[model samples]
Target: MSKTNAARILDRLKLPYEILEYAVDPDDLAAESTAEKLGLPPEQVFKTLVARGDRHGVCLAVIPGSAQLDLKALAVLAGDRKTDTVPLKDVQPLTGYVRGGVTALGTKKAYPVYVDELMLTFETVAVSAGKRGLMLWLAPQAYLTATQGIVGAIARSSPP
Candidate 1:
């Protein structure tokens, strides 16, 4: 598989990461499904979400696959009075990645990134490799270092 922009950034930073590829299920692009395919707990797989703050414009939220982005919490972290997830159609143009492939690394623009505090509890986490069907596995600290992400309680359990 050809290296993605995200991977190239990691390479330049001299960070060690492993790229894992899986089949893409167009009908099921949920990060939870990707975790299941990789035989990992959903909590270990992080999903990147694009959100726009009323004041800050756009930022990326990295939360566990099984959790939902807490917009209010994110707003607090981003110092915005309000925040909302960007429309699906705007994701690619804003981040240069499709819906199932958004990552903080190598975005078309460098947006502030906020990662859920839960990620620190895990030794490693998996995030999109800037495209669907591929995941990058690296230590939580390594991921943070690469993205310079802020750590906060920006996630909540998904409603049943």
Candidate 2:
């Protein structure tokens, strides 16, 4: 398989990860759908989100696809008064990654990366490979180390 920017970075770090690929549905880019395509639980498939804090600049939020980011919680963790998702139009320009393909590993900007504390609960978690239709699965610690991610309660379960 061809390497993505994220894959090359991982290789440089010597981080061992498994790459998984699935069919893409341009009309349905939801993380839940991606999880289903891979036959994995929604919680195991993480989604990368970019947000800007009032006090801080832009940052990346890696949360479970099954969960929703808590702006208030994120703001507290970011040491800011508030946090808001970056506009869809700005995602690619800001992070060098488009929606559904943003990963903390490789970005246009090295914005602070904050991962959901819940991620550590799992033995392995999946994240975008900085491209659509691809995901990287590795030990939680490996991911944290790769991105120098801050672990905190930055996410809350979505309502049923």
Candidate 3:
């Protein structure tokens, strides 16, 4: 079901993408860990985060595995007073994809999407393929076009 959704999205966009599957230990499901397990650079891997803002409504943020989402920056970008992570329990139903499988593209709802500027450093980036153990490698522009996402610096340096 997950791979099907991702394939459908790719077909619709007419974009070329490569799907990479790897073994994922349920207990270690995190972007950085996943990247390490896949032998990919952390900066080339992105994590989809669901956040709600006071005025901009619910939005999706895609940031590097090594960076943190800058709530204040996101709020400013969304023209809102504040931003908060959406509850995990509500994420699946809200995005139509399970927790670790959430992708900015092909979501159940069409919400505003913001991509961290860091992703631009890579010619191709990896993101979840609507399922755990599966990832898609594609050009960053394809994601923006597919999701109608806005690109900006909504990421902060990882806590030291």
Clashes of each: 0, 0, 0
Please give, for residues 35-89, the per-residue lDDT of candidate 3 as tens digits: 9988998889999999999997889999999889999988888888999989999
TM-score of each prediction:
0.98, 0.98, 0.95
Q: After superposition, how far is residue 108 of candidate 3 from its true place, in Å?
A: 1.2
Residue-wise C-alpha lDDT for candidate 1, range 119-146, written one tens digit per residue: 9999889999998999999999989999
lDDT against the true structure, each candidate:
0.96, 0.92, 0.87
Give the Å shift of residue 19 in candidate 1: 0.4
Candidate number with greatest lDDT: 1
Show where candidate 1 strays beyond 4 Å.
Answer: none
Task: After superposing candidate 2 on the true structure, give the runs of residues whose Cα lies further than 4 Å from its correct spot.
Answer: none
- Residue 53 displacement in candidate 3 (angstroms): 0.5
